[model samples]
Target: MKKNFYHLVTATLLTVVLAGFSSCGEGKADQQAAASQTPSLPVISLPVKTLTGYQSYPARIEGVINAEVYAKISGYITDVAVDEGQKVRKGQVLFRLETQSLNQDAAAAKANVNAAQVEVDKLKPLVEKNIISEVQLETAKAKLKQAESAYNSIAANIGYGTIKSPVDGYVGAINLRAGSLVSPSSQTPLTTVSEIDKVYAYFAMNEKEYLNFIMAADGGVRDEKIENLPQVTLILANGEEYPQQGTIETVNSQVNENTGSVNFRAVFDNPQRLLTNGNSATLRVPKTYTDVVVVPIESTLERQGSTYVYQLDADNKATATEITVKDEINNLYIVSDGISKGDRIVAKGIQNLRGTTTIQPQETPFDSIAAPIKKSFR
Candidate 1:
C-alpha cells in the first residue's frame, strides 16, 4: 500500500508538471498569433504643401484675324499669283482674272470719246459763226462728258478683276485655280487669309463653375475680375504644354440656353506660328492653394458622403476621422479642416484597415509618399 501511494503521488506530480508546461506553451503561442494579426503600415505626419490644381476644358483655337478672300467681279481666274500657305502682305494680288474682254470694251469707249470730241470741236466753230444754234454745241459737249464717264466706269471694273488680299496673313486653301470661274455672288470664297501672329483659345464653363470663378476673383466688376484673373495655360493635342502663357481676355455675359455654359476667350502669342486657325487644344486654368495642409488621396476613405482618414494616435492606434477636403490636387487632397499640420496619418494601404486597430507604425517621409504624385502630375 505504501509503494502504491508513492507511485500515485509521483504520477500526479508528473501529470501536473506536464500540464503546466503545455499551458505555458499555449500562452506564448496565443501572444505570438495576436502580434501577427497587427499590420505594419506606413504612416506619415501631415505636411503643409502648396498644391496647384487645374480646371481643364476643351478649347477651339482661331487666329487673331480670319478673313475670306472674295472676288468683286465675275471672271475666270487667268493667273494664280500666290500659292496656298504662302505669306502675303496687304494689297498683294492673289488672283488675276482675264482682262481681254474688258480691254476691248475700254478701247471702244475711248473711240466713242474721241468721236464725241471731234463733233464738239466741229460744232464750236460753227456756233461762233452763228451758222448753227448754241444748242448744237451744248449737246455735243454733253455727249463728250457722257463718253468719258463710261470709259471711267469700265476702267474701275477692270481693276476689280484683280483679286487682292485685304489683310496681311498666310493664305489658306485656294478654292479657285486658273481657268476656274469666280463671281462676286458665289457662295464660296477664293481663299482664306489668316493672321496667326496670335491665337485665341475659346472655351466654356458651366453656370456653377462660372459663379465660383467670379466670386473667387478679387474684383467687383466683371472687367476688373478678368483683369485680376490668373494666367491660363494651353495643353496641346499631343499632351504637351505650349511654351507661351495666355491671358483671359473676354467672357460672354449671357449663358447659352442649349448648352448652359458661359464662353471664355484667352489669347496666346504665337511667335513661332505653332498655333493656327481650326486647331484644337485644352485650356487649363490653375487654382493654387498656398501652404495648405495636404494628405495623400489613397489614405482617404469615403463613407456616407463624408471623407475620412485613418489618423494615428500616440500609441499607433488608427482611428477613422472625418476631414474637410477643400480641393483635390494630383493624388493629394487639400484638407481645410478636421486635420492639421504635424498630425500623423496612414500614408497608404488603408483599404482593409478597420476602426481603432492597433498598427505597427512605420515612419515614412512625406516627400517619399508624395514623390510619385509630383512626377506624374505633369
Candidate 2:
C-alpha cells in the first residue's frame, strides 16, 4: 500500500508540472497572435502648400477672320485661279464665271444707247427750231438716259463674273470646280478664306465659371477684367503646348439658353503659323492658391457624398474627418476646410482604414507625397 501511494504521488506531481508548462506555452502563443492581428499603417502629416495649377477646357481653333467666298452671278465656272491651301490677297480674283451671255446683253444695251443718243441729237436740233413739240425732244432725251442705265447695269453684271477674295487669307476647300454652275443663291459657299496669321481660340464657360473668372481677374469692372486678364496657355490636340501665350479678347454678352454657357474668344499671335483654323485644342487657365491647405488625394475617402481623411489624434488613432475641397490639382486636393497645417494624417491607405483605427505613424516629406502630382499635372 505505501509503495503504491508513493508511485501515485510521483505521477500526480509529473502530470501537474506538464500541465503547467503546456498552459504557459499556449498563453505565450495567444499573446503573439493578438500582437500579429493589429493592422500596420503608414502615415504622414498634412502641410500647408501653395499649389499653382491649371483648369483645362476644350477649345475650338479658328482664324481671326474667316470669310466665305461666293459667286455673285449665275454662270458656269470657266476658270479657277487658286487651289485649296493657297495664299490669296484682298481683291485677288479666285474664280472666273462664263460671261458670254452677259457680254451679249451689254452689246445690245450699248446699241440701244447709241440709237437713243442719235435721236436725242436730232430732236434737240428740231426743238431749237420749233419744228416739233418740246415734249417729243424731252421724250427722246429720257429714252437716252434709260438706255444708258440699262447698259451700265449689264456692264455691272458682267463684272460680277469674276469672283474675288474679300480678305487676305489662306484658301480653304473649294466646293465648286471649273465647269460647275454656280449662283449667288447657292447654299454652299464656293470656298473659305481664312486669315490664319493670327488665330482665335473659342471656348465656353457656364454661369459659375464666368463668375469665377470675372471675380478672379485683376480688375473691378467687366471691361477692366477682360483687359487685365492674365496670359493663358494653349494645349494642342497632340498634347504639345504652344510656345506663344494667348490673351482673352471677348466674352459673350448673354448666356446661351440652349447650352447654359457663354462663349469666350481668345487670340494668339501665330508667328510660326502653327495654329490652324478648325483645329481642336485645350485652353489651360492657371490659378495660384496662396498659402492654402492641401493634401494628397489618396489620403481622402468618400462617404455618403462627403470627403474624409484619416487624421491621427493625440493617441495616434486615426479618426475619419470631413474636408471641404476647393479644387483638385493633379492628384492632390486643395483643402479649403477641415485638415489644417501641421496636423498628422495618413498619407495613404485610407481604403483600409476606419474610424479610431490605430496606425504606426511614419514621418514623410511633403514634397515626397506630392512630387508626382506636380510633375504629372502638366
Regions of candidate 2 where Cα sits further than 4 Å from its true position: 1-38, 375-378
Candidate number achieving the greatest TM-score relative to the actual structure: 2
Models 1 onward score TM values of: 0.85, 0.87
Say which candidate scores most in lDDT: 1
Give the per-residue lDDT digits (tens) of candidate 1, residues 201-312.
9999999999999889988888899999999998899999899999999999999999999999999999999998889998899888899999888789999999999998
lDDT of 2 by residue, 1-378 (tens): 999999999999999999999999999999888768666666776767777888778999999999998888899999999999898999999999999989999999999999999999888878889899999988999999999999999898899998999999999999989999998899999999999989999999998998888888887789989998878889888898899899999989799999999899999999777887899999987888888888888778888999998888998888899999898888888998888988888887779875688766777876687777562234
lDDT of each: 0.91, 0.88
Model 2 lDDT at residue 70: 82
Runs of candidate 1 with Cα error greater than 4 angstroms are 1-27, 112-146, 373-378
